[model samples]
Target chain A: MNFPPPITRLIQHFRGLPGVGPRTATRFVFALLNKSEDELRAFGHTLVDFKHSIRTCKECFNISLQDPCEICSNQKRERTLLCIVARPQDIQAIEETREYNGLYHVLGGVLNPIDGVTPEQLRIKELLTRLEGEQKFQEIILALNLDIEGEATALYLAKLLKSRVPKVTRLARGLPQGADLEYADEVTLINALKGRRDI
Target chain B: MNFPPPITRLIQHFRGLPGVGPRTATRFVFALLNKSEDELRAFGHTLVDFKHSIRTCKECFNISLQDPCEICSNQKRERTLLCIVARPQDIQAIEETREYNGLYHVLGGVLNPIDGVTPEQLRIKELLTRLEGEQKFQEIILALNLDIEGEATALYLAKLLKSRVPKVTRLARGLPQGADLEYADEVTLINALKGRRDI
Candidate 1:
């Protein structure tokens, strides 16, 4: 037999989430069902509030509470060093390292022709406009993923921004921190060897 | 840096779900953020409506749209056969099999003294009351899991239900369909050997 209509509806909504299949969605629904009416209502309100409050930063295309985002609006951040990323969440990952003190530009997603993710679909035009405007960055860092799509996007952006920016660099590819050299893939080993630095 | 306040709140809520870690929770929140405002609002409304409309079945203790539940109220189901399970979700699993036509009794949880899950906390009292009342069942099946706690509960319930009902039966333990005998655990293999039947 099928679940109740309300349960099924909630499950369907949860199934839309990334990596969440029917079973996981069902578990989430049941877990929510166990909560008190007040707690459930609060969760619902939180969801609505999240949607209502969240806005994409017009400058960087990053999702935030404000239009320009806290990073783009901050005066102390290094305007000369611009880091380009694939998505808003990637900015969080870079920020967590606390190593870089620079502005960011979110590309929305990497260029994947098969998936219909073209330059127009992403924020490439916006990035070009921002770079062409008053801001003059000394270096533009393409901090996208190490996948084929990310590489293609990075190459495309690097070529496009070479004339506008002084230097275009990508994040170094090497054996990740705490990763065993024995388990390192052939390409990672080759990259690590090719990009070796003197201590 | 951490996510925005609303995103963090929703992430916290998602993290409270079974098997969902902080990363998975963050992914879920971001996925929700990607949805349109109206769709997100509808999802929020669905959550509230789910909690409001859904109620525990007074007869079987299963979570359902109505008090008695569709199963408890159905006339075609076999009232003479009652199946006892630990959680409400177990009823859905058994119903999916379509092998049994009996009514159900949800015990909420098995008796786990270490975790403070005493008989008092379970629906043991309700089961006893039902058995003692006018609903006479020819066979009471204990369809709990095959783990230590389930075994303990099944044994306890079988003994208690023996005097009340004409017969008290537990689900047959054997090698599961398509399960490799070579990789079978010792306990399961022993059970399979002991419970061997004629073809």
Candidate 2:
């Protein structure tokens, strides 16, 4: 189909985003075209600033606006209690509970060798370094997904943290299997938090 | 949930897109953040150019890189055969069939009174002007969707075009009701084309 060059290019660009196929990409382009001139320019400016404005925390390896992130920098946080999760968004899910007042380690993703995601590819080194640093974390919690990849990652990290940290624990079997921590309700996460047991 | 400020802002921006909700927007933002820096920058550049690089055709009101749009400007197109569609993407769906060699007029959207969309709000005036112009369109095809709004708009246009053009027809009622032309299969459109009846 001979869409005008610029419109076709715009659709292709939209398709590059995750989960957006050809039809969705075309829909996005049309939606953008229908927007007001000011709104379009603002959206473009936001896109330009999106990558530039975000920073990875030096300690937690989470996406944020600052080097250490607000969660890592907050004085009230229980620095001795560290919770490790797969992705940055998982931290939001955990934080919403207000049940655990601990620091975090964002792995960015889990260990999935089939998908070419290895331990080294994740922020595992950073997690280890943070544990080794001045912050004497007494408890390290593995708050990962209940899937095969998440299980493998948990086992690998648990083995590593057990020798160094005073106590190493997993989020317990309360969360339904195959569920993402990012999408889990606060009650479910809270239950998992309360029932957490040492690995 | 308290996501990092910049990350949250990016999620909100993505949620503004059609068909995207809170969860999908968050997922899109995370996926984008996972992309390589160069790819992210290139995507930003494309977004900036998206609105700036495109123009509306003076004659058809369709989005294009040029003033009159490629379809309206092409001399080889059947100047007598004009296809009226709801949006620019509809034109792509129709063009995919390679069945219609006519020009198009994009109404931007169909009239929905409850949505405050009146005739004056759409490109109806431009469509009427085209009918009154020197270019004698022998057949004006109302290729709108099969929805209530689409049906209403097509009927309105058909009534108006019947008096001006030698022939005014609509795509056959072969399409399923409430289906968007943008998502209709090429085969469906082709069948509708073959069975078109006079309005």
Local accuracy of candidate 2 as per-residue lDDT tens digits, B85-196: 9988788889888999989999989999999999998998898888888988999899998889999999998887788899999876567879889999987788778878
Among incorrect, acceptable, medium and high, the docking class of model 1 is: medium
Point to the candidate with the largest TM-score.
1
- Candidate 1, after superposition: displacement of residue B194 in Å? 1.5
* CA deviation > 4 Å runs, candidate 2: A174-199, B175-199
Give lDDT per model, in order.
0.90, 0.84
C-alpha positional error of residue A55 in candidate 2 after TM-score superposition, expressed in Å: 2.9
Per-prediction TM-score to the true structure, in the order listed: 0.96, 0.82
Best of the candidates, DockQ: 1
In Å, candidate 1's interface RMSD is: 1.3
lDDT of 1 by residue, B105-187 (tens): 99999989999998999999999899888888999999999889999999898888888899988888878899999998999
- The lDDT of model 1 is 0.90
TM-score of chain A of 2: 0.84
- Candidate 2: Cα lDDT at A130: 80
RMSD to truth, every model: 1.6, 6.2
